[model samples]
Target: MIKEKAKKKWDLTRKMLEITDDEYNGVTQEDANLRFIKTKLQIAVYYLRMLDEHNCEYEVPWNKEQFKWLLRKPAGDTKKQKAKDWCHQCCLIRDKACASWSYEEATA
Candidate 1:
């Protein structure tokens, strides 16, 4: 069951990458390419953090991509604060059951 849940989370992560890639349109294709790559790295970091909190055994490794993503600060202070808040929310919900879970888990 844990493996199945993990697979679904991974699939959702990949879908997010696809959505972001499709949404990317920058000054140059190279710029969009880099943004897309960085977004994927960010998603990977998000997923890894989730897995870590769950004590899940997975092969995803720490790399420079994740490091660069962490180092990047949004241009505007509001944007930076929003990003920080979002990460905090993700952390808060790590142990909680998904809203889409069956009623038993959802109600528990």
Candidate 2:
């Protein structure tokens, strides 16, 4: 049973992740945001499907650090600085993916 909330969330995520026909009918896996969003939705759907299979009520963690709303960014940082830092970090979910983000995590 797909809940209204889950359906909406999945729809939104899918739209953000997929490239439109106008966007170069040919796609590349090198697009980081597109790749990440695809992987994230896969995990979300996997968990939801697992819940259904087990007849369990799956509670999405709306407070996970992986989600932008739950992210803790440095205070007083400018958009340019943040964008630079994000590039430097490459949005690596793995702790040791980059030294700069690793340093940020350590200090934060």
- Per-candidate alpha-carbon RMSD to the true structure: 12.7, 14.4
TM-score per candidate, chains pooled: 0.36, 0.32
Model 1 segments more than 4 A misplaced: 1-25, 65-108
Please give the lDDT score at residue 48 for candidate 1: 55
Question: Once model 2 is optimally superposed onto the true structure by TM-score, how far is the C-alpha of residue 39 displaced, in angstroms?
Answer: 2.1
Candidate 1 residue-wise lDDT, 79-104, digit = tens? 34443544444444543434333434
Candidate 1 differs from the real structure by a C-alpha RMSD in angstroms, to one decimal, of 12.7
Off by over 4 Å in 2: 1-30, 63-108
Reference-based TM-score, model 1: 0.36
lDDT of each: 0.48, 0.40
lDDT of 1 at 47: 54
